[model samples]
Target: MKKTKIIEIKGLCVRYNNISILKDIDLDIEEGAFLAIIGPNGAGKSTLIKAILGLIKGYKGQIRIMGTPLSSFKDWDMIGYVPQKAAHIDRIFPITAYEVVGLGLKRGIRGNNAARYINNVLSRVGMEGYADKKVYNMSGGEQQKIFIAKAIVNNPRILFLDEPTTGVDIKAQDAFYELLKSLNIEGMTIVMVTHDIAIVNKYVRQVACLNKTLIFHGDHDEFCSSQNAIELLMGEHHLIAHRH
Candidate 1:
């Protein structure tokens, strides 16, 4: 069966001070897909995501989310975002997990059941037991999970993450990916900007390589074998052998 395109972009372009950040980008992300956006530093990977989220505007192009034009898309709750390393958050701030997740709730979720719903979201990321603990006391991986819970608490249809695992311990990265995999299985499409090409092959269903333009976008198998991928990745990196 053919999948529906959850996100569609055409002629996407972004500029800063007359310098092109992204140019003529065209891409489509299917429903329920776990897509990894990879590129070198300063290659406009983050800019592309920000543009799609409508966080950074003044660009030229068409962007549609769930079949509606971004400019007309009023259902912001359907989209979840976990920025790079959860940078917007103060790592040492004294805040509980429950409170963090609560901050993401839609305006309608209030009164009696709101607290229960917040706990339920925390449980989704295996942080139910630590809801009372201060976020600053948790490890980097644990903090990441808390932020993820915040993003998902609203039950977003699509989740966008920017370098989510940057500060996480190497050993815990696998577990973190598994959590994201579970969310994808439950029908939340995921689009992540990452530098870890190795994990891209292991966890994500699709890959999009960007370097100020759409370099490549396709299944991992095709990406691994495509001449475009080889040429673009040449001298920069190599796709690691897929591990079971």
Candidate 2:
């Protein structure tokens, strides 16, 4: 039995003003797959995700989420997104961690049910005990976990994370990846955009290298073994057994 495709992109193209951001992009994400989109800065990786999320307008080509065209897909709740650092979060805002996660619950899960749902997600990320903690007091990693809890509080089938470990410490990053791996094992589709090469080789099952177009898209091992990937990502240096 073949796996179902959770996301499908065909001939996708995006432009801002008059310059092209992405051109002729094609990719597929299978159900339960952990896909990492990696590339140098300004490579249109973020643009691709925004296009799929319908955050960008006037994009050419097709994007389908769970077999439904982007324009026709009405199941926004089924998809969850954890943006980098919750970029707009004001550290001094004085909101509780639970309240932050609660914002993800746009509909349903009211009252006790809502609290229970939020608690469950927080617990999954190992931040349950900090439910009442002020967001500003938490470390960068702790705050990132809170963001993850918020993204998953709604029980989304597919989760998208952008630069999830950007400011996290090494220990916190390890724990974070473990949580994500557990979620993927339990049947959640994960699409993460990152510049972290180490985590890419360790956690993601699929790799998609983008530089205004699809440079490579296949298994992790295949990507690691490819000369093109090594050149594009690691520069002129050969990939050593361990990257310091």
Candidate 3:
């Protein structure tokens, strides 16, 4: 059986000040699929994400989520997002990791249920012991995990992460990818924008390459074999791989 598409974009074009960033993008994302949007900087990758999130208006084309037009979905509570860069928070803000996670339950909190939800999310990210620690004192990876917990605390159906592993250590990157994969296995639709082809091949089931254009979108092996991908990444960027 063909899986139902959770996201559909047709003839999508985004422009800023008369400059086109994304051109004629048409794609479909199936439910529970892990899609990695891979491209170099200035690829209009971020613009595409913003368009899907409805953060950018006045774009020409159609975007639909879960069989409904993007504009029609007034309640976006089902979508969870993690930005590319973590914002700087005050060191002395007087907030604990638990409190940070608890913010995800901003809609409503009844009794100790909010606390339990926070604890469960933190435990999922392997930050069970750091719930009481100040956010400033925690390492970058730990802080990222906290943010992940915050994103998933509400049990969103679709999770969008932009460079979730950026600036983290190798071990942390591996663990973070594993966490995302586990969530994907548990029936979460994940759409992530990343420049890491190696990680994308390892963790994501599908890959899409963009460079102000939709170059290719398909399986990992096909992506690696595409001439367009090679020209975009290796030809223009001068990236070389030594094979014995």
Candidate 4:
């Protein structure tokens, strides 16, 4: 079986106030890929995802999504994103999980069918009984689940998550990754940015290391076996560990 490249980038560079954040980077994301982007803070991991998703503008390069240039691409519903710090969503504001997921529903889907779809998405994320639960009252992990449900309720082909498990408990992180794994198994492409190197090997099919530029891009097995890649990650001060 062969996978098609759904995302293609060439000479991608991003800058702010004359300061370069990323430079001359090229990346291709195939359909159904589970890729992990890892780097130190401010290494442009989030910027890269934002750039690819067309959230940030004025970058020097070409990006094509689903074979259409990003400048001409308009099918946003095909892409989903969970931004960093989403776990800390306004604890003081009262909003139910069902309403949260509804935010992602397409304008055309409504009435009973929309209601059932939202509930089904909630169940898929293991937040089934939480459809009516207040996000402010739920645990950090549970709130994260609601956000994921919102991201996926649109039935996007590829999902992007930035630091999805930050500030989550270990137990919750395990469950969260398991949910992501199941989603990937069910044929959803996922691109995630994480500071956790352990997760790079634990769940990702591809590993891309970044630092103002692409330092490495390869399969997880190659990353684990290459001393140069290991040393490069060590320079970033990320703990390197092998998963059994």
For each of the candidates, give the backbone clash count: 0, 0, 0, 0
lDDT, candidates in the order shown: 0.87, 0.87, 0.85, 0.88
Worst 10-residue stretch by lDDT in candidate 1? Answer: 235-244
Task: For candidate 3, write residues 23-122 as lDDT tens digits.
Answer: 9999998999899997888888888988999999899999999989998886576787887875345886878898888877647675688888888899
Residue 15 CA displacement from its true place in model 3, Å: 1.1
Output the lDDT of residue 206, model 1: 89
Candidate 4 residue pairs in clash (backbone atoms < 3 Å): none
Ranking by TM-score: 4, 2, 1, 3
Winner of 3 and 4 under lDDT: 4
Q: In model 4, which regions exceed 4 Å deviation?
A: 235-239, 242-244
Question: Model 1 off-target regions past 4 Å?
Answer: 87-92, 242-244
Positional deviation of residue 88's Cα in model 3 after best superposition, in angstroms = 3.3
Per the 3 Å backbone cut-off, how many clashing residue pairs does candidate 1 have? 0
Ranking 1 against 2 by TM-score, winner: 2
Q: Candidate 3 at 78: error in angstroms?
A: 1.6
Residues 1-244, candidate 1, lDDT per residue (tens digit)?
A: 9999999999999999999999999999999999999888898999988998898869999999999999989998999999986834565688888888888998888866788888898887878789888888788888898898889888899999999998888777888899889889999999999988788878988889888999899988777776765677665777645545
